[model samples]
Target: MKTSSPSDAPRPGHSSVAALLQSQGALIALVSILLFGALRYDNFIGWQNVSDVLSNSSKFGLIAVGMAFVIMSGGIDLSVGTVAVLSSVLAARYSNYGIAPGIAAGIVVGLLAGLVNGVLIARFRLMPFIVTLCTYIAARGLALIISDRQTVSISYEHGFDTVGQGDFLALPIPLWIAAAIVLAGALLLRYARFGRAVLAVGGNEEAARLMGLPVVKVKIGVYVISGALAGLAGVIVASQTSGSPTEGVGWELIAIASVVVGGTLLTGGQGSVLNTVTGVLLLSVILNLINFENGYTGGAHLTLGSYWQTIARGLFLLAVILLQSRLARRSP
Candidate 1:
């Protein structure tokens, strides 16, 4: 009988460590940042600042969630930001029709836009990057035309404003909505057959097809989900800012950054919804710290403005990419 040596035995702890790094790395980073901020700043631990962070993070969190799904499916939706703005424009335009109608209209527009993306890419075999880029331009123009290149205000009396600004249990309503989306996304990606198929397709499309998976349906479904979530994000933005056609400009980059920082592979087939949330919070905290630093110095010493924030974001993205590359190389 052959006897197994120490080196031949499987090392469970090693695998566990690797899994933890893969799944909760962003969470670890977030916690570290939070601790650092709390210790370094005076008001960073204040309730008001915390609330502000959660509230502001909600909109981007929602968009990032959808983008996470798309990225996991080996696809990208560059138009999500513009799509969100378009949805906001439509929601504001329909606000007078009643709250339900207003919200429904925004969601429908998102669904329709997603359908177009899905059909074009999955059916016609078009490149996702080019298709979404085209939609990005078209959606922006549509938003401009619909809102007449102006900010469309939602009536305060219609209860539509409360969806974003109101609070429950002392937390902003948008935060609650974002939490719900994240939970639902986690469940979908964890326990659903559709989720498994998405992973399969993303991991290996040809193999997925050979395995009798609904490759086209799964691909299209992810885009539809992305579009609908982006639309919901738009509605939330409209409620918060009284509606604006140009609200989500440059948000696509932020969403992508969040996904990348969350430890999700840009090549797709690997990501976590919870990690994406952590990524959003991490970026928000960093921005908040920058604002605090700027104000603390009274624009004299460290007067880093929005441009600095952009640079910081670019640097953070570069660091994450380099880390990912090293990790990938180390993996067996």
Candidate 2:
């Protein structure tokens, strides 16, 4: 019998690097922004400004947290934003249907969307890219059709305001919910048997199947989870705005960017929910800084606006992929 050396058995040296990146990427990025802003702008790190960033980031954080699971399972879901729009619209319609039906309708629609993706990917072995892209188009079109290409306002729904405007411990209800979901997701992914199953399936599907893991089921399960969360995010967004199908374009890109920036492997298998959370915050923070600085400067810097953010996201993704490729080549 032969035993592997302690150093060779997933020791502290290399493992910590990924962990650090996941846990502190946002904080480090935040610090970097402050340092840069402090040198460049007069009021980059003000208190109200910080809150604004976190507040704005929370919505994207909700979707990114869900996207983390999908990406970790070696899959993608481009339809999340549209599903969210569809769900939010349904939620508003449900207001007429009553609260229970509204919530149920929204959740069911999202679950069904996930089901479609999961079935195609797991049972039919379709590529995640094509499947999700089709759903993206389908879901967005369906949302437009249902809403008649108009925003459906749910201001009349009883307690509708509470869903988005309520507070918990001095934080917004949506933020609290996001935090709770993140905690739950982190726990499930890190400590549960199901979590390991997800990781194994993503890391090596054939091996997971050989080990008797329910690979198909796990993959399907993650898509469902992702869809459900996306739907929930939509509901929250609708609640905040009192309208549906109005603000859900390009959200998938934001979610995907956060997932990648969070340290999740684009190839799948290696990542963490916490990292995704940080990534979302990091992005939100940068955008917040941009907005704050712009406000002070009279919005003269349109170049530092959403377009710049998109370019930053692309550059960050390219950098991470290249770094990972180099590291993979160096590793055993």
Candidate 3:
């Protein structure tokens, strides 16, 4: 038997602390922010304000859930945002047909875009970053073309707008939809063999392949799922805003930032849908706070402009990335 020195042994409590930081850090931060906002603002804790945060966060939360899956599978989908825009354009165009057809068309568009990405990456063995980046541009162009570079409004008479605006069980329709997606995602990731394969592939593709895992299939499947969710998000967005080809601009960065803030490794192989939801709420709350701050100081020399929100987002991204780097180093 080989004798090991104390220095070589795992540090007691370190693993637990790191795990806590990785898993619950975003939750902690979100709670702190909520407390701060409630204390700092007279109306931040009101039901109306709370509802706004939850409802607005749902759209990004849906996208972030998909992003968590892709990032966990060691891949990225830059096209998700523009793909969403394209889906929204399609949904608006088809809204006159009926709500069912409109929703189906939007989702199908997303699925098709995802399929192209999956084929390029899994079949052609292209880099995910490059493939998704190209698709991102293409999707944006397609959205612009389909909508004639304009906002397409959905007719309210058809009830198509209810998808985003309606309430279920006293919760916003988008929040209900988002909750369902998150629950389904959590189950699939925690209890499915496909989910295991995803983790294995992300952890080490070559090793997973050698172990007889369906690496290619898993890789392709994650993108498909991501695409489908993004599409659903697009439909919700279209319903909420009537419709717009220009929507979802820069949403990809927001999704990525949410994932990172949620403690998902950019290198992949570890993450949680629940944590990603927390991250979405955190970002949403920050933006909402900025809005409140701006309103409170309106017409004042010290007013924090909308640009301050952008700067704050960038800084938050930087801080999360740094934290991720440090956590990676500390992990055994």
Give the distance in Å from residue 299's predicted Cα in candidate 1 to where it truly belongs: 14
Q: How many Å off is the CA of 55 in candidate 2?
A: 2.9
Show model 3 residue runs off by greater than 4 Å.
1-10, 297-302
Return the top candidate by TM-score: 3
C-alpha lDDT (0 to 100) for residue 270 of candidate 2? 79
Indicate the TM-score of model 1: 0.92
Where model 1 places Cα greater than 4 Å from the true spot, the runs are: 1-19, 297-301
- Backbone clashes in model 1, listed as residue pairs: none
Of 1 and 2, the candidate ranking higher by TM-score:
1
Give Cα-based local distance difference scores for all models.
Answer: 0.85, 0.78, 0.85
TM-score of each: 0.92, 0.85, 0.93
In angstroms, the error of model 3 at 59 is: 1.5
Best-first order by TM-score: 3, 1, 2
Instruction: Quote the positional error of residue 260 for candidate 1 in Å.
Output: 1.6
**lDDT (10s digit) by residue, model 3, range 1-332:** 98999997668688667667667777877788889878777799898899978988887988898888889999999999999999988887788888898899889998888888988999999999999999999999998888888998986778898998999888899999999999999899899998888888888889999999998889889899888888988998888885687788899888998998888888787888888888888899888877777776434433566787789867875776677567656756
